[model samples]
Target: MHLVIVTAFDYPDGGPVAARHLALTAGLAQEGHRVSFVMLHQARPPAGARSNPAITWTSIARAGSTSPLAWRLTALRRLDRSIGSAAATGAVDAVLAAVRDPLLLEATLRAARRRGIPVLHELLEYPDVVRPPGPLGRVQEQVFVRRHLPAFDGVLVISGALEEYAARSGVARTALLGSIVDTALETPLDPLKLTTTFTVGYAGSLVQEKDGVLTLLRAAAAAAARLAPRYELRLEILGDTRPAAGLTATRESHRLGLDGRATFHGLVPHDQVRGILARCHLLALPRPVSRQASGGFPTKLGEYLATARPVLTTAVGEIPRHLRDGETCLMVAPNDEGALARALVGAASSYDAAREVGRRGRGLIDASFSAPVQARKVVGLVESLRGARP
Candidate 1:
């Protein structure tokens, strides 16, 4: 099958967003499908990294425009042309679009419908769930989920939470293809390669409203205070640590008296993330439950589990279904700093058992959520959609 995947972000950019898309593209190509990755935003390919010939990468939007409205108009116009061109050339059987912008989604759907191509809208996050939550988010939900989503031929959701959301919105054809990771790219480092410090690493945005990093900080501080003189809990946070909701992760670290214990390495390349994770004893994703979390799964969880490192995270979203507490991960209730601190101490006290638990998580990924496995599932979904046609 020939497929065109449209996304609203720059490609070859190191992040879970790009990683998941890249994995899916590679997987589809490996499954003998001709796949083209269409980026809604223009980006330069990473230096020294060659393009994946199996997956054609292209962009419909031009960069360096000063006016937001002008760029949007231009991109919408280009989107129509691109979809028409792909259809006219008879090079694509279906179109799969993943974009946060409701306007972009509407444009893509309109263009694809005009071209008679089966379009699949991939929902990664719910519009109602946004940081600094307000009316704009509700407006997006109205436009995208309530009004436009059901019109698509099919919907691909990243989590069961989004699948339920789609079902409630009258979308009958929905696929729950949760976050994916290339297990081959992420393997546990040798125990001898461990970092000198007892590091607990968290990757991704430090935005308190989104990831609950502040809670993790408080828990870490509490755990450190309790475990003082026995073990010093060192935190290495990779990714953007900038302020959101009036304070940054670093500021909170100081407020909690975790001066030297907490080290923030603001955004690094995606390729470098695994290497950093390899240095940590455990990975932490302390996201609190919210409308946002309920509708999506974190891509980092897959990557973290792939590293075969003990992960401490809250039972939010579809996480409880995938990761069993005390089995594949050390789980705690969302927003409970005391529970988080206790989980941290438990992970520290039972280091060997935690390593075994991490190993089990890696095994689970191999059996269910590896890149190849997810790619095959996506291929199956695409096949089903194609077969449904007359």
Candidate 2:
């Protein structure tokens, strides 16, 4: 199948969204599917950014637009043209869109409809989770999710929660395409090797409300004091330290007396993240229980597991369904600093046991969360849609 993936994900080296799409597309290409990745937003690729030769990349920049209205109009026209051209080639099979904007989503549906091409909406999270919408935006989101979403040929969801949500919203066809990682790229580290300092690493957003970074900081401070007698504890955080809007990790780290022990490496190249994670003795994703946390699965968790490093995370969302508490990873209750701190100390104390858990977690990734595994589900969805179409 020749699939067109339309998204706002930054090209080359962006964030988790980009990483997810890249891995999925690579898997699709490996399955002999041709992919055209269309970027709706303009982003400057950072140094050391790399591209895949199997996929074709296209950018539709909102060039010289002064206002939101103007940019939306320009984007719609350009996207329509782009889809039309691809449809004219007769090689394009379907369009899978990861766009969230209601207006743009409607435009994409219309464009695809005009070309007799089916459009599938990719649902990553609950509408209210990510940058929460305003009153007006909420109204738009409701209309889109309830009325517009069901109108798509199918919906591709990233989590079981999202798949159920889509099905309840009257979407006839829904596919679960959960958190995926390129297992081939993630080399597991030896669990028995001892480092001078026991490092707890976290990659992704540092926002308190998002990933519960403040809770993590407080827990780390407590863990540091307890681990000091046995081994020095270091905290390594990688991601955008300067969020557009939210609580910053650095200020909280200092307030919690972890200034000297914590190191923040602001957004680096995507390929380098796994290597850095492998060096750490432990990885964490202490997301608090919230609508956002339960609705979407963290892509970083798959990467962390792929590294075969013992992960300490909360029991929220679909995580418990895929991983066992003591078998695959160390699970703790969300929003509890004390529990998390204790879990961290326990995992460090029983390093050999934790390493075995990490090894099992990597095996789980290969069996369930790997890109190739999820991509096959995607291929099945597309073929079913094609067969049903008159």
lDDT of each: 0.77, 0.81
- Look at candidate 1 and tell me the lDDT of residue 270: 74
TM-score against native, each model: 0.91, 0.92
lDDT of 2 by residue, 1-390 (tens): 888887766755667777888778778877777788666775333233335545776667665544657656667879988887666655778898777778788888888888888888878888766534578877877778776888988988888999888888888898897777877666686664655578899988877777888888899999989988777888888878767422367887888888778988888787677667767899999999888888888888888898888999999887887888889999999999999999989988889899889989999999998888888888888889888889
> By lDDT, who's the top model here?
2
- For residues 147-263, write the lDDT of model 1, one tens digit per residue: 788887788788887788788888878777776766666666666223334679999887787888889999998988777666778998886755463257788789888888888
Q: Give the least accurate 10-residue stretch of model 2, judged by summed lDDT.
A: 42-51
RMSD of each: 2.5, 2.5
| Runs in model 1 lying further than 4 Å from the true structure | 43-50, 87-90, 130-137, 192-196
